[model samples]
Target: MSSMLKASVQIDARGARFGALITAIVFSVALVTQSPALIMWQAAVFAIGAFRGPQFTPYAVIFRSVVKPRLKSNPIFEDVRPPKFAQAVGLVFTIIALIGSLLGSSVVFSVAVAAALAAAFLNFAFNYCLGCQFYLLGVRLVSPRNSKITLEVK
Candidate 1:
């Protein structure tokens, strides 16, 4: 029963893509406008996603309630854990970017935001999740016996 319940709560791949698109747009706007507040907001969103899970994230919620319903086909689902871990990674980057902006360090701020933007772009454009890959790698390193480290849609 527990296993069945777990299988039923799979993460939606389309929703993840929507999240990546939203994140990329936010980061791009922040970079272009040099708006620290935007970066901070993005950081907060990522933090919420990481701590509370993606379903509660603003972009994910929008995707679930607004976007998913409009789609003609069924959404694909994957393990929820990897994307949650990925959100944590995004939070770390955005925090660093926010700190750099607050410190008035343009170099640090640019580099951090650029790196984050690149990752987000990869996810949005190519459907490649750098943070999710990192999570999987960490899981594999720490628990070689666990076969669930790979991020495959079930």
Candidate 2:
């Protein structure tokens, strides 16, 4: 095959995880308090993250501008796409939760919020992103032989 490259934006893993942590906390609070307002705020964040890169999210912006200055470790970069995909997943769940809340169906809202919290917590605590895994699985299944994708930090 001819040489071809697909460049991907490299994201700082630490920053992304920090955002995940914030997301987890937000989701946790939303679930606990059953606050539709908070959930709406989170959904906006997820929408921004999904449409833009995770690096562009407000949480990530905070990490980059504030928390990052205190850390001594080198920045770790990763593909930008996966996080975006994860945000989309989060958005989906968040929308479901919102729908449930608006419809006065506590069960649907609780379940959806809990699921989102679990995913965000897993990513933050274990550095394991569930949505990213799904994306990777899809990629593997669709393009087992495709090696043209290359990562480049912007």
Candidate 3:
């Protein structure tokens, strides 16, 4: 990958890390209220994590911040998919939520809370990004580019 792209990833990941922090704060408050506001804020956080915006925002932030630039320059590391792993986490969490919702288990909500906290913690501390990995492996399976062992970003 180009230096510019690697730099971009770092910047974005840093920003995303901050954003995740904000989301964590918001989530903590919302949990007490069980308010609709929580859902809105959570959606915003996911949006930041999932899409490119006016700024590098969420996903890019994870990419940019979690890994070193020199490491990012390596072809193997450059294509590593954090987003895809995040997606998988979300999907698995959602499935649990769905089942719990169907069964009317209040514990499902609690489980979800734990999962979200884990994800944010993983992002903040370990730099283990699941979202990018999820996008790369789960969503892009049909793409020709993803079919290859090596990814060509350009």
Candidate 4:
């Protein structure tokens, strides 16, 4: 695995965990009547983030931005590829949720919300990245050439 992917996975776990916990709390407290605005906002954020690719590249940019001796000596993040599998999974889920929401299916909406929560928890609780796994599985199944770039962690 590239160092960037590894570092982002660690950081994403943190973001997902925190984001999931708060969303779940809000969901449970409000029950089935949770605000649609909040739901859409969160979903949009995830979709956008997934689409745009890694949001944690700043670490690399920061490292490269400065010429200080200490900054140059430090090695916090490795040269890693962005987690494509995770991004694809998130994108697919987002698309599904969007379609369901448009169709006015409460069940679909709920599932989408739950999926997001699960994703967040999965990252934080188990450090099991469904996104990365999904992406890898997808690439392997669809394109052999693409699979060459995917990292398999043992």
Candidate 5:
């Protein structure tokens, strides 16, 4: 990991989970309605999260301002990279969904949105972060010399 990655911020896992729930809900609505606008909205959120950092993501901001203040539980901290990676994954799927919607390919659109929704639902419902797993797998494969990358990132 680079120094920036080393210094990368941590996130409140509770807030992240809450964000996942919101993401799932949004995607669900989009999937049901087949709304390109909704997919674009989510795509924007994912882009911001992936590029600017997860804290700046729309739902994360909502959680920080509206939800976190009401919660009495202690904050569960985790490295931000995994969630950031997750956002990038979401962005990819949303883009694909948007493309499919624009091109009138129901199969592609549904599959893309559904995949993203499933990932978000998994994160929200079971705390099974598929993107985080992929990120870990990537680190393990790409940085075999730094086997501690996972530990360090976490």
Candidate 6:
């Protein structure tokens, strides 16, 4: 791993789930109200999480400073890269949704936001990080050649 990846901070998995839950809820509200502003706000939140890491995102910050401390159980810390990558993916979708909304294409906007919302819902409800899995698959595909790894046996 590169120093930059290694240097990434550790974050509580619970906090991450909390952030995802908050995102899902926000997206749900935005969809119901057909609020472009709310979608833009979500995009901003995802951008912050992608660029500054989860610790600096509003939901994570609130979870860390407020909810985590009040919890009775200890937090489980995990590598931050996966969630960061996920947030980047979310940012892309949200930006698409925002642009679509601004352009007055309800179909485009709804599709993009709905996809992101589904991913967030999965993460929140099942602790399944679709973005994280994609990140891992991407790393495996892009990594340097290996001697033994193969899809078929000779």
Per TM-score, the best of the predicted structures is: 2
> Which segments of model 2 are wrong by more than 4 Å?
1-4, 136-154
Per-model TM-score, in order, reads: 0.80, 0.84, 0.47, 0.53, 0.83, 0.83
**Per-residue C-alpha lDDT of model 3 across residues 57-149, encoded as one tens digit per residue:** 443454555644635343323332354335335445545544564676657755775576667667766776765445557656766564355
Model 4 residue 87 distance off true place after TM-score fit, in angstroms: 4.6
Q: Select the stronger candidate by TM-score from 4 and 5.
A: 5
Off by over 4 Å in 4: 1-31, 53-88, 144-154
TM-score for model 3? Answer: 0.47
- In candidate 1, stretches whose alpha carbon ends up further than 4 angstroms from where it belongs are 1-8, 136-154
- Candidate 3, which segments miss by more than 4 Å at Cα? 1-11, 53-105, 131-154
Count of backbone clashes, every candidate in sequence: 0, 0, 25, 6, 0, 0
The better candidate by lDDT, 1 or 6, is 6
The full ranking of all candidates by TM-score, starting with the best, is 2, 5, 6, 1, 4, 3
For residues 14-95, could you state the per-residue lDDT of candidate 6 as single tens digits?
A: 9989999999999999888888899999889999999989778999889978898899988888888778888999999999
Residue 11, candidate 4: C-alpha displacement in angstroms: 6.2
- As for lDDT, the candidate ahead, 3 or 4, is 3
> What is each predicted model's overall lDDT from 0 to 1?
0.83, 0.89, 0.51, 0.50, 0.89, 0.88
lDDT of 1 by residue, 11-49 (tens): 888888789889999989988888899999999999888
Location of the lowest summed lDDT over 10 successive residues in candidate 1: 145-154
Q: Candidate 2 overall Cα lDDT vs. reference?
A: 0.89
lDDT of 2 by residue, 1-154 (tens): 2323667789999998999999999988898899999999999999999997888889988998899999999999888877888899999999999999889999999999999999999989998866646877777788766445543331
**lDDT (0-100) at residue 27 of candidate 4?**
41
